[model samples]
Target: MVTKESWSMSIWPMAPWKITFLIYQREKLLWIGIQMKVAAGAAKGLEYLHETADPPVIYRDFKASNILLDAEFNPKLSDFGLAKLVQLGIKTHVSTRVMGTYGYCAPEYALTGQLTSKSDVYSFGVVFLEIITGRRVIDNSRPTEEQNLVTWASPLLKDRKKFDLLADPLLEGNYPQKGLHQALAVAAMCLQEEAATRPLMSDVVTALEYLATNKDAGQGGILEEPEEGEEDHIEADS
Candidate 1:
């Protein structure tokens, strides 16, 4: 007979999951600059996992819900149950069981069992799209053409003229258009069908870092800072 023991741990005491749908639904929580910050933070976290770990770890499941936000809105990654450690060897990719959220998994990983850091990159691209568009990865309630976010948005991402159509309406056209283009370009590269073509997490981190730093660049000549006493923790969607 085999014996098993289970332990429960509270990963997030007061912080909440950083689901873009919930964050954008709130009136004052969605800001272009803030979104950039969140993206950069998440990228840095993934970069650390891919590059700093003793034997690099592949975050098999990377999505908006897996990202958590503290009271200050700082992002942190959670749910390491599905994480896999890469062995120190000459192997280029790890072969494993296919597992992850439906709309966020990489096509190759979903079809085959091959897992790589790039799989996480693809999932990050989906979440990055969600943050930009303020939409869910898969929303059946939406119109037929708009039901699947990536399917509808991917074609439009390449054309700068159509970039505005993909932005979150809640932004009210207040974001820097140039920044939007740059961010979308990063997302597009990450979403590449070929896993080998996708940039490394370190590269992704650099791109997002630039976006976060220059968020105010094209903001129609008006850049306003948050008020001193404003609430930091916005209400989550029901």
Candidate 2:
């Protein structure tokens, strides 16, 4: 599935899943053009899964690891073991067992075995949170209860003053403050505890595209102090 760009991508070292991450070190290209292109590509991949996949594949187990990357760092979503298909008239898909990475599971589906399109929405929200924060979905270093990524991050998303605290320390504060705020709102919508409130994947993709396009005409920054050695959160689309 190469788009003919120097051609250097392969799914080597397969594990429990069929995905692999592109081994990018610190920063690759700081150009606004490349970054926005990668972001849109990621959004489009998710859009295909939600709107184009037959029966609309619900990547029930979406996580950072499940997102593979290409030479250009474009995201390619992987792993279909837990993928679900919603029938034409069926409200939801039920499975005998709930299966998903602990930190990536949608709350409602985690409690009840019923899976829906919104379940994947919640996972995307988690991925969005990681993209914004540059943090792992589940880090054990945090205090009990706080160790849960979504629960800990959800509150900060609602408050601007507090939201900055969640940004990756490496970024230091080198991005568009207002744009970051807008992205936070989008993340809040996707991470809604109630599935009914989350935006459709198509809507999420649209919002991201608009943000990138609007910001492209001006400056390109994600925080106040961008660290040259900051880790890239390109896995957000996984």
Q: How high is the CA lDDT of each candidate model?
A: 0.75, 0.65
How close to the true structure is residue 60 of candidate 1, measured as C-alpha lDDT? 87
Q: What is the TM-score of each candidate against the true structure?
A: 0.82, 0.76
Q: Candidate 1's error at 79, in angstroms?
A: 0.5
lDDT (Cα, tens digit) per residue for candidate 2, span 1-238 = 3346654344444332212221122132332233334445566776787788666777789876777655555666766777777777786887889999998888888898778888888887787676666667887877877777788887787777776677655555555555566677778898888899999888988877776665422133243333354324222211
The candidate 2 region of ten consecutive residues with least summed lDDT is: 17-26
In Å, residue 192's CA in model 1 sits off its true spot by 0.5
| Backbone clashes, each candidate | 0, 11
Candidate 2, residue 100: how far the Cα is off, in Å: 0.9
Q: How do the residues 1-238 of candidate 1 rate in per-residue lDDT, one tens digit apiece?
A: 2334653344456775465645546544445446777788888989998899777889888988888888667888898899888888743564666788899999888988778889999999999898878888999999999998899998897677787787677767655556667778889999999999999999999888776665243321111233344224321112
Question: Model 2 off-target regions past 4 Å?
Answer: 1-39, 216-238
